[model samples]
Target chain A: MTTTVIEESFRPGELEVRPDGTGNLLGSRCRSCGAHFFPTREACAGCLSQDLDAVKFSTEGVLYTYSVVRQSTPAFEVPYAIGYVDFPEGVRIMGQIAGLEFDEITIGMPMTLSLEPFGENEEGDPLTGYRFRPAEVTND
Target chain B: MTDVHVVGVGMTRFGKHPDKDATDLGAAALLEAVADAGIDPRIIESAYVGHVFQGMVTGQRILAQVGLAGLPLSNVENACSSGATAIREASLAIRAGENDVVVAVGTEHLTSKFSGALTPDPSDPEAAVGATMPGVYAMRATRYMEDHGMTREQLALIPVKNKANAARNPLAHFRKEITVADVLESRPIADPLNLHDCSPVTDGAAAVIVMSDRAAKKYANGRGVRLAASALRSGSVDVTPTSMTFEPLTWATAQDAYERAGIGPDEVDFAEVHDCFSIAEVLRVEGLGLFEQGSYPWAVERGEADINGRLPINPSGGLIGKGHPLGGTGVAQVVELVRQLRGEAGDRQIEGAKVGLAHCRGGKAVGIEGAACTVQILIR
Candidate 1:
C-alpha cells in the first residue's frame, strides 16, 4: 500500500490551500477607503477605519522591479530572483520569482502566483508556500 | 527654552574589533567624550545609549564601567538611527531644562551579531518571502536606473568616491582607495550592487556631550558648536504605492530640521548623509533638497560632491567606506560634523566650513517606506 502526504499551508492566515491544489493569498480590504493590505491589518492605514474585510487577492500581477540575490541568510539558498509585484488592488507584494532563469526575468512582465512545497513542518509534514511565475509559463 | 550645544564628541575607530564588546567600546567612547569636554564626570546629569542586538541595560553597563552608575539612564534602539535618536533625546533634556549636561552614546559589535546580508525582523511578511537588505536596495537601484537612465558605470563611481574619502580617514574601516573598475569587478552581493556598494559589518561606538546654554558658557571653554536642530521622524504607512527611488521620510525629517534651524539646504557647507548603500546617498541628498532629482550621478562625475567641491557629502567616508556599526553610525555622523565645524579635521577638512548637516535613515518594515530617519544641522 502507498501512502500520500497531503500538504498544509505554510501560514494559514496568509495562504489558503484548497483540497484541489488551488488557493489564493489572503489580505484585508478597507471597506471605507477601498485600500488593500497584504497579510491583513486590523485597521486601514489610509483612513484609519477598523471596518476591514478579509479577502483573497487575485493571482495575476505586474512585475515592478526585481533583483538576483547572491547572498542571503542561512534559511534561503543563494542566487534566487526576488521581485515586487504590483497587483490590480493597488498593493505591492514581494515574492520569489519562479519558472525563469535569473537573467530572463524582466520588469513589467505579468506574473501569477504558484503554490509549491515550501519546507517541512515542525511535525515533518510537507508545507505549501507561494511563488510568482511568468503568467504565460503558468498556462504551460 | 534653552539652546543646546554639543560641547564635545568622541568616536571609536570603525572596524572589526574581535577582542572588544559593545560595553567596552561604549565606555571608551563615553570617557573620551567627557575628557574632550574637559568636565568632571560628576557634572554629567544623565545619559542615553543606543545600540542594536546588544542585550538590555547596556547603557547601565557602560555607565558602571565608567564609574557613573547612579544617574538616570535610558537605552535607545531605533535600528540604524539608534544613535541619532539618543542624541535627540539628550537635546530634549537640555531644551526642557531637565538637565544641564547630558551624554548620548551609540555602540554596536555588529561583526559578532550578524554576517552576510541583513534581513528585517523574522516576523515581517517580506522577510518571510526571502527579502534581504541587499536585495531590497538592489531592487531600488534597478528601478532608479530604469527611471533615470543611469548607467552602471556611473553607479560604480559612488563607491570609488567614498573609498577615496575613506583612505584619508585614519579611523575608517577601509583606508585604501579603490578605483571605479574595482567597484565594477567586485563580488556581487545582489544584482546591480556589488560588494563595494554595501557597508561592511563593523564594531564601533560614538558619543556626544550636549549642554544647556548656561553650561556651555561655563564649561565649553570656547570649543562648543551649536546644535541648531536635531529632527527625527518615523516612516508612516503608505496610503498608496509610492516611488521606490525617492524617500519621502527623509524629506519630511529634513524639513523639520531646516525649519527648526532657520536654515535652507543651500547653506549647507558639508554633509554626512548615510550611505549604507551607494544608491542610498543619492536618495538622501536629493531628498534633503541639496541636489536635484536624477541629478546626483552627473554631479558626482563632475566632482561636485568631493571634499573640496561646492557641497562635500559624506566626508567621513560614510557607511560604505568608513564602516557601519548600525547603532554607532548616526552618532558618528554628528561627530564628523562637529569636527569639521571646529576646523579640527586634519586631512579631510572642508575649508571654512560653517554649517554641516548629518542624515541617518534605517530599518525596514513590511509596509513602511523606512523605519526611522534623522536630520541634524550644526552651526559654528
Candidate 2:
C-alpha cells in the first residue's frame, strides 16, 4: 500500500496545515486599531501602527462575489470558480470555490475553509492548500 | 511657479508591431512630438519615459536613438498609469521651473512580454489561488448586474459603442466595428465577460511635449493648450470592506484634478477613460462623476455617450477599441484628448470640444481597491 505524503501547507505565510488535514488561513490582527488583514501584515494600514499580532482567521465566511474563470495562465487549470469571501474579521479574502457547481455559487452564500490536496512540489510531493466550500448548518 | 502648456503631441498607430520593440516605438513617437512642436531637438531640457517589462535604461536607449542623449531622463512604472504618470512628472518639472521644455513618452511592447489573461504579481495571495485579471473584473461585473439590475445585453452595448468609434480611427487597433451580438457571442474568458469585452494585448507608443509658459510663448505659435491639472493617487488600504462596484480612488484623483483645473464634470466636453474591460468603462465614467452610479448602462442605451451625444466618452476608441499596451495606454489617451481638443480628430472628432479629460487606473493588490489612478485635464 502506498500513502500520499502531503506537505504542511502550500504557502506557509497564508495558511497553516495540521497533520489531520485541518488548517486555518493566517492573517494579522492590529493591536492599535483593531483592524484585520489577510496573509498577515507588518503594520496596520488604518492607524499606521506597527504593533500587530499574527492570528488565525475563522473557518467560515460569507461569499461577497464570485466568477467562473474559463481562462487563466498555465499554472492553473481552466474553468475553475473563484470568489471573494467576507469574514467577520472585516477582511475579504479570495480563494477557489469547491464542492459545488459554478452555477450553484452565488453572492452572500455561506462558506467554510477546507484544506485539500493542491499541486505538486519540486520533487512531485503533494501539497495542502485551502479552498472555500459551502458551510455546514446545524440546529439544536 | 510656471504654468505648463502642451505644445505638441504624437503617437504611433496603436496595434501589434511584430518587427519592432519598445525602443523603436518610443523613439518614433518622441521624434514626431519634437517635430510637431517645431522646436530644435536641443531645446528638450529633459525627458520621462514610462513602460513595464522593458528592462533597465529603456529611456536612455530611446534618447540615444533620437540623438537627444545627455538630457536628464527618468524611467517610470506605475502599472497602467505609467505613461500618465510620466506626463505628470514632465509637467511637474516645467511647473517647478527646473526645465523649460520636457517630453513625456510612453511605450510598451506588450506582445513580446505577455499573453493570455494578465494576473497580479505571482506572489500575491489572490494570484496564488488562481486569480486572473479577467476573473477579477468578471466578479465585479456579476455583482454590478445584481446590484443595479443591469442586463447582459445592456452591458454589451459598451463595446459596440467603442468599436463603432474605433472604426473611424485610422490608427486604432481594431478598426472593424463589432455589434452587441459579437460581444455576447465571443469566446468566454470569464463568466459575464467575453474576449471582446476585454482589451487586447497591444504594442504601441505615444509622446507629448509640455513647455513652461515662457517657452510656449516663444514657440507654441498659438497652438498650445493649457494643462490645467495633472492629478495622481495610489489606492488606500481599505479600512473596511467596501463595495467593489464603486471606485473611491478614481473619485479622489478626479476631485483633485477638478479642483485644480477649476472645471466641473459637467463642463467636460469629452473624455478618454481606462476602459480595459467593457465594465471598466462604466466604473470609470461613473467614478469620475461624469455619470451617476448605476446610471451608465441606461445612459449608453440613450446614446448619451456617443460622439455627438450630450457628452462624448472614449472618442479615441479607448483601450477596448484602441490597443492597450499598458504604459502606452495612458499617454495615448492624452494624445487623443489633445487631438480632439484641437479639432484634429478628423472623422471621430467631437465638434467644438473645449475641455478634455483623461483617466487611467491600473494594477491590483490583494486588499486595496486599486493600485494607481490618474486624472489629467486639458483646456483649449
Per-candidate RMSD, Å: 2.3, 2.2
DockQ score of the complex predicted as candidate 2? 0.79
Tell me how far the alpha carbon of residue A90 in candidate 2 is from the true structure, in angstroms, after superposition. Answer: 0.7
Per-residue lDDT of B86-141 in model 2, one digit per residue for the tens?
Answer: 99999999988899999999999999999989999988889989999999999999
Question: What's the true lDDT of residue B46 in model 1?
Answer: 97
- Kindly report which residue stretches of model 2 are placed more than 4 angstroms away from their true locations once superposed: A1-6, A137-140
Best by DockQ: 2
- Give per-residue lDDT, candidate 1, residue A113: 85
List, residue by residue over B1-380, the lDDT tens digit for candidate 1: 99999998999999999999999999999999999999998999999999989989999999999999999999999999999999999999999999999999999999999998999998887888889999999999999998998888898888888988999999899999998889889999999999999999999999999999999999999999999999999998876778999999999999999999999999999999989999999899999999999999999999999999889999999999899999999999999999999998889999999999999999999888999999999999
Residue B316 Cα positional deviation in candidate 1, in Å, after optimal superposition: 0.2
Q: Scoring each candidate complex against the real one, what DockQ results?
A: 0.75, 0.79
Which run of 10 residues does model 1 chain B get worst, by summed lDDT? B236-245
> Once superposed on the true structure, which residue ranges of model 1 sit more than 4 Å away at CA?
A1-6, A137-140
True contacts kept of 1: 0.76
